[model samples]
Structures are given as C-alpha cells and as structure tokens.
Target: MQIFARNLTGRTLTLSCDKSTRIESIKDQIYTADNEDGNGISPPQQRIIYGGRQLCDSRTIEDYNIQQFSTLHVTGSLSGGELVYKFIVVVFSIAFGVPILKYVYRQYVSKLIESATESIANAQKRATERVSGAGRRVTNNRLSGRFK
Candidate 1:
C-alpha cells in the first residue's frame, strides 16, 4: 500500500509500505527522500505524526491504525545540544530559582511586618501622649481654680 508523507515545507512523497512495516523504516525512507531534495534531515530527527499522534519507531503502521493513502506529517526534532541546554536551564531554575524567590519573598514580608509594627507602635505612643497631656491639663485647671 502507498501512503502520503508530507513535510514541513509542503513537500509530499508517496511511500510504498505495508501494514507490518516499522515506523523506523518509514523514517529511513523519509530521510532518503528528504536528502535527495537537499534537506539533509536524518531519520532520528524526523518525527512522524498521524491522526494527531506521534508515531514511535518501534511501532508498526498498523499499530496506530494508519490507513492507505493517509497523510503522515513529518516534523524535525530538536538537536541533542538544544535538548541538553533546555535540560540544564530547567535544572538550574529548579535548583537556584526557588531559593532566590523564597529569599526575596521573606525579605518583602519581613519589611512589611516591620513597617506595620512601627506604625502600630507610633500610633500607640501618640495615643498615650495625648491621654497624658489631657490628664495634666485637667489637673492644672483644677489646681488653678482651687487657688483662685
């Protein structure tokens, strides 16, 4: 049976394959076809998607229920170096990012608490001074009135 293989550049190739054909064989054929067109894509870098599912190399076409003349979309995968770089970025973010974020959050919360405490202390001091001043004024008024 023949199936249609489409690449990212809208290039399609009719591949002759059987239901028992492994997905790896299809990838090899795709690589050869792409190389002929000067694309130079390797089999490992080629990702075949059918029915919205990625085809595994170890699986057969019939395993995924790929029908005859069905269109298989091919996409290039990320290089090993790119995958390693992404892994490193994720590891570093997890290792250092969490601690840095926690430190910043603690500092912010500490400053907020300190500011609130100072505001409350200042308010209490003002209230105490006002109450004492009022009491002193009343006492002076009473003393002055008694002397008169």
Candidate 2:
C-alpha cells in the first residue's frame, strides 16, 4: 500500500508499505531514508502518529486500520531520561506544591493570632494597673482626711 509520510520539517514523501508491516519497521525505514548515506541529521527516537493516535511499535498497519495514502506524522519521541524528568516535575507540582503553599499561609496566620492575643493581654494588664493606682490614691486621701 502507498502511504504519505511527513517528517517534522513538513517534507512529504510517498512510501510503499504492506499492511502486515510493523510500524516500528516503517520508522526505521524512514530514519534510514532520512539519513541516506549519513548525510543529514536524524532524530534520536521517533513517535509515529496516525489518525490522532500514537502508533505502537508492535502494532501493524492493519491493526490500526490505516488506509492507503493515509498521512503518517513523524516526530521526535522523548528519551527515557526526559520522560523521567517530566514525570518528576508533574509529581512535584501536584504533590508538593499545594502543601508547601498551605504551610506558609498557616505560618503567617499563626503569627498573626499570637500577636493579637499578646496585644490584648498587654492592654488588660495596663488597665488593671491604672485601676489599682487610682484606688491607692483614694485610700491615701481618706487616711489624711481624718486629720484635716
């Protein structure tokens, strides 16, 4: 069957492939064709896509019901290391990000509550001292009033 294959750079080519051909084999062929005589740059790994679905390396054209002249998109696939890095990033963003932010907010709120309570206690102490001082002054005046 004839298939229209396009590389990442939008270069189109027509290739002959049998329905029983594994998708992996087709990728190797394209890679080989791309490097024909080791002349041009080629990607380290590949991802084959057709009909908006990623074609599996172990699957055949017939398995995907790929028709003749169907367009296959060729692009670079992430390496194992890159995939791991991406996974780590996603995991941290979900698992650690929210909790860290919440912890910081909790710290601020706790400090605010503590400061408010301390201020209130200080004000009450001052009020008590003022009342006691006034009572002492009145008592002193009464003691001298008997002499006057």
Q: List pairs with backbone clashes in candidate 1.
A: none
- Local distance difference test values of all predictions, in order: 0.83, 0.76
Q: Write the per-residue lDDT of candidate 2 for residues 4-62, one digit (tens) a residue.
A: 77887787767789999998888877877777656423533778889899899998999
In model 2, what are the clashing residue pairs, if there are any?
A: none
Off by over 4 Å in 2: 37-44, 80-148
Candidate 2's error at 27, in angstroms? 0.7
Error of 1 at 140 (Å): 47
Give residue 34's lDDT in candidate 1 (0 to 100): 76
Q: Give lDDT tens digits, candidate 1, residues 1-148.
A: 9999999999998899999999999999988887885875688888899989889999999899999999999999865686775676567679876655456569989999999999999997777566434245334235434345
